[model samples]
Target: DVKVTQSSRYLVKRTGEKVFLECVQDMDHENMFWYRQDPGLGLRLIYFSYDVKMKEKGDIPEGYSVSREKKERFSLILESASTNQTSMYLCASSSPTLLSNQPQHFGDGTRLSIL
Candidate 1:
């Protein structure tokens, strides 16, 4: 079975603060992604990494960055947190195969609140 674990289920931070969200996958997947979910916008990809130490910006990458120093771990960093960045953050992992339609396994998500 595949499993993606998020460091936090809920988080609270103040404006202008730096935040780190961590995720770990046990399936040894070749691809990992970070996404923020909002009421109307749905899931917006922030970043994704296909290999260790390699990252690519996704749909919404402003004010956020990602690090994948190790194969099993991926971290999302919010350089300067703001109220508008408050949302549910999700981590997902997928196997890199010829079939691009493979489903990504996701974490339970971290509900973040900025004040």
Candidate 2:
């Protein structure tokens, strides 16, 4: 079974502090994504990587960045945590095949709070 593991299930950080959220996939997927889920805004994309060391900005990449030094690992960096950034962060991975409907596997997500 494909598994995506997040470094933490819950985290708290002070405003203006830098935060790092880590994710690891065991399925050797080539595509990985980071998203933040909010109450009314829904899930908004943060960043995504197609391969090692390759990343692209997603819908909301202003206060965030991503690192993918290895195929199995992806890290999301919050440059400076803010009160508005508090939300549920999700990490997903998928294997791209010939079909465009590839399903992505997601971690349980990390609920982050910025105080």
Candidate 3:
């Protein structure tokens, strides 16, 4: 089974502090993604890495960035945490070839709260 590990199950931060969320996958999958889910907006993509040492900005990448220095790990950095940025952050991993359904398995999610 593919396993994805997230750095935190819950997080609290000030309105302008930086935050780092880490994710690791044991499957050595080539695709990793970061998404922030909100009550009404659903899931919004923040970033993704399709291969080692490669990263791409997703639809909502304004305050986020990603790093994939190794095949099995991906990290997300929030430049500054804001009240509006408080949401459920999910990390997912998928095979390099799986595109149908975008069938990526996810972590339990990190619930972040910015005060």
Candidate 4:
């Protein structure tokens, strides 16, 4: 089974502090993504990497950045934590096959709070 592991299940930080969230996939998937979910906005992709060291910005990249140093690991960085950044962050990985419609495997997610 494809398993995605996130470094933290929950995190709390003070405003202005830099925060790091991590995710690792066991299946050696070629694609990984980071998203943040809010009450009204729903899940919004922040960044994604299709290959090691190759990343693309998603819908919202401001105040956020990502690093994919290894094929199994992806890291999300909150440049400066703020109250508005508090939300549930999700990490997912996917592999493309000859067949269409590959579904992404997701981690349990990290609930972050910026105080």
Q: What is candidate 4's TM-score against the reference?
A: 0.95
Worst 10 residues of 3 by lDDT: 94-103
lDDT of 3: 0.90
Encode model 1's per-residue lDDT on 38-95: one tens digit a residue. 9988999999999999999999999999999999999999999999999999999999
lDDT of the candidates, in the order given: 0.96, 0.95, 0.90, 0.94
Write candidate 3's Cα lDDT for 24-112 as tens digits.
Answer: 99987899999999989899899998899999888999988788999888999888878888899999999877465657999999999
> Against the hidden reference, what TM-scores do the models get?
0.96, 0.96, 0.93, 0.95
Task: List where candidate 4 sits over 4 angstroms from the true fold.
Answer: 97-100
Q: Clashing pairs in model 1?
A: none
- Candidates ranked by lDDT: 1, 2, 4, 3
Model 3: residues with Cα > 4 Å off, grouped in runs: 98-102
Error of 1 at 3 (Å): 0.4
Clashes of each: 0, 0, 0, 0
Q: Write the per-residue lDDT of candidate 2 for residues 1-115, one digit (tens) a residue.
A: 9999999999999999999999999998999999999999889999999999999999999999999999999999999999999999999999975246899899999999999
What TM value does model 1 have?
0.96
On lDDT, the leading prediction is 1
Query: Worst 10-residue stretch by lDDT in candidate 1?
Result: 95-104
Superposed Cα deviation of residue 7, candidate 3 (Å): 1.2
